[model samples]
Target: MDVKEGNELKEFNMLYKEVDELYHRIALEIGLSDSAFFILYSIVEFGDGCLQKDIADHYFISRKTINSSIKNLESNGLIELKKGKRRDMHIYLTQAGQKFVEEKMMPVFELENGVFEEFTGEECRQLIQLTKKYVMLCREKIKETYHLSSEDL
Candidate 1:
């Protein structure tokens, strides 16, 4: 890797960390733990039939972490688990959860949406495309190093 490549990686990592920190602060301000907020956001975004394994894969976190988050959200009455068509446990947001998101999360997203104020729609799309590609590349590298199948992680 060249100096430019190293710098780009560093910048991307810094941005990722900054965004995570911002999420933590906003989650706390809205009376939720960071993990609970992320879990609730995923449930709301995915709507019904979202499985625990799906959330774990989506966040690249452990099932244990997701279980903890789900427990917290359920205890708060922000979400519930139901049996899916396949008899799997699925996560769904409750009415109170939807109301809270409307009154709280949407505003937070609206404020954070300013991050792309200087970019055109196409630019934002391109960034997301490139980021997804990078994520796949990283996954491949991990699989190679661990000699594991996609299902293993």
Candidate 2:
């Protein structure tokens, strides 16, 4: 890449890391670990009885990390797990969990919504489209670099 392209890539990476850091700070401010916050956020996004696997896959987190956060949330009385029809566990928010989400998670959702509200519809669409394209291109490059097949990813 040329110098300008390289600098642009660096700027993009810095912005990405900064966004992640902002979320981590929000998690800390709400008295939760970053993983725990994301776990709860996933539950809120996906609904009460979402599967742990689904959360992990959707968030690109490892199952092990999801499991650890699940244990912590359960211990804190924020969530409960029950066996599904297929014998896999489904997570549910407890009564306290519902209250906790109402207090903590909803504001974050609102904040996110508020940010989007500032963007025009076309801008929002372009942002999402470009981001998805960027991710797809990155994944393709990684697979090519490592000689990986689709199944491996």
Candidate 3:
């Protein structure tokens, strides 16, 4: 879709709706909630040295939300957390977590390729750059709204 008729906020919502649906569908297929699966998938992809706060920072999710999701992932034996030097906690994926992520993401990538493979290499690179740009924009907006900086997160 060209998205010729909508404002930035509208385009944002449109993208979010599709993204949410895909995530929810995939999560349901894997017997997990969309949010939990995303959190776990992220931890697995990024490896365990990621601080608990960094997950929230990277994802633009609230610390409290990530905390609860991490707890659930931990209780399921899918992940573990180790206390760091200060108040920080490091996250690591378990054996089950690794296998689960690999199995679930293979089809997800196939779906992505089927849908987006038409884009040229330049276009693909542009999309990645745009995603990074939006992430930074979101970080600034979040800092404005929540009074929390990435430095402290």
Candidate 4:
């Protein structure tokens, strides 16, 4: 790449790391581990009765990490697991979980919504479009470089 292109790539990577660090900071502020925060966040987003596999797939987190976090949450009585039809477990928030989410998770949602409120609708659309395109291209490049198939992803 030319100098300008290389500089742009560096900037992009820096911005990506900054965004990740911001999430880590938010998790710390909320007194939760990164895995736990993401687990709870996914549950809230996907609604009750979401599956462990769904959370792992949606968030690109490892199944081991997801399983560990689910166990922790279960022990705390913040979530419960029930058997689904096909031997998979469905996760649900307990009464305490509902209150916990209302107290802890709601503020994070409000903060995220507030930030989006500052952006124009067109800007938000562009941001999502560009991000998705970048992710697709990145995945393709990784696959090509490693000779990986879609299933590997």
Candidate 5:
């Protein structure tokens, strides 16, 4: 690749940084880091309480990072462990966590939605679906670049 190509990729990183900054600001206002809010959001959005390792697997984040985020969420009274038949711990949000998401997170999402209000309803769904697919592809590519297995990831 030429210097021009390299510069374009670097510019892409700047765009990524801008998007991350928006999410970070929205998360901070609710008194939770981006990582913790994502975890709680995923748990509440999905009916099944995810196992610790399962959550790490689905999110493509390091087990250690997930553990640290879980710890922080637990400390903040946003989530709790549900002991059940399985050996792995099932993580769920507390009532306070749900309430916070309802009150705080809903507004944050509203702001984000407003930022993209140019899109129609169908366009919004398609965009979100494509974004998730693109993110998954990027994660898979990163794992391959590192010669790491899915388990290793």
Candidate 6:
């Protein structure tokens, strides 16, 4: 690749690492395990009563892992599980959980919003679109190399 493309690729890798580190650091600052923080963050972003399976699917994580996180969150009075319309469990944040999100996690959301505010609306939209396209390209490459489909995954 040319120099410009190579620099962009390097910056992308660095951004990924920096974001991951920041996520972990935020979890620590909020006194939550990384998994618990992620679970909470997902619920907050997606809304309450989200399905356990949905979360597992969203993260491409095993049900057992999500289940463990759910249990831990419930034990800490951060979340509650209720029977859904089907046999699935619907997860919701408790009053304490809401408080925790407001106190500990909202700052992170605000910070992200503040950063986004630095860019124009169109720039942000284009960035998201391009990133999603890049992700799909990588996924397709992985599937092709592995001879696997989404169903297999």
lDDT of 4 by residue, 1-153 (tens): 646645778988999999889889988887777888888898899999999999999989998999998999899999999999887999999999899888999888999999999999999999999999999998999999999999998
What stretches of model 6 exceed 4 Å from their correct place?
Answer: 1-8
The 0-to-1 C-alpha lDDT of every candidate, in the order given, reads: 0.83, 0.93, 0.79, 0.90, 0.77, 0.88
Candidate 3 per-residue lDDT, tens place, 1-153, comes to 664665987877789899889888888998887667767767655765688787777777788888898889889987888999889898887888777767875567687788678899899999989889987988899899999978954
List CA RMSD, all candidates: 3.2, 1.7, 5.2, 1.9, 3.7, 2.9
Best model per TM-score: 2
**At residue 54, what lDDT does model 4 achieve?**
92
Each model's TM-score, in the order given?
0.77, 0.95, 0.70, 0.92, 0.69, 0.87
Candidate 6, residues 1-153, lDDT tens digits: the string is: 646645788988899999889999999988887777878988988899988888778877678888898898899999999997868888999999999999998998999999999999999999999999999898898899999988774
What total of clashing residue pairs does each candidate reach? 0, 0, 1, 0, 0, 0
What candidate 5 gets wrong by more than 4 Å, as runs, is 5-7, 112-117, 121-153
* Most lDDT-accurate candidate: 2
Which 10-residue span in candidate 3 carries the lowest summed lDDT?
40-49
- Residue 35, model 3: lDDT of 60
Q: Look at candidate 2 and tell me the lDDT of residue 153.
A: 76
Model 5 TM-score relative to the real fold: 0.69
Model 3 — TM-score against the truth? 0.70
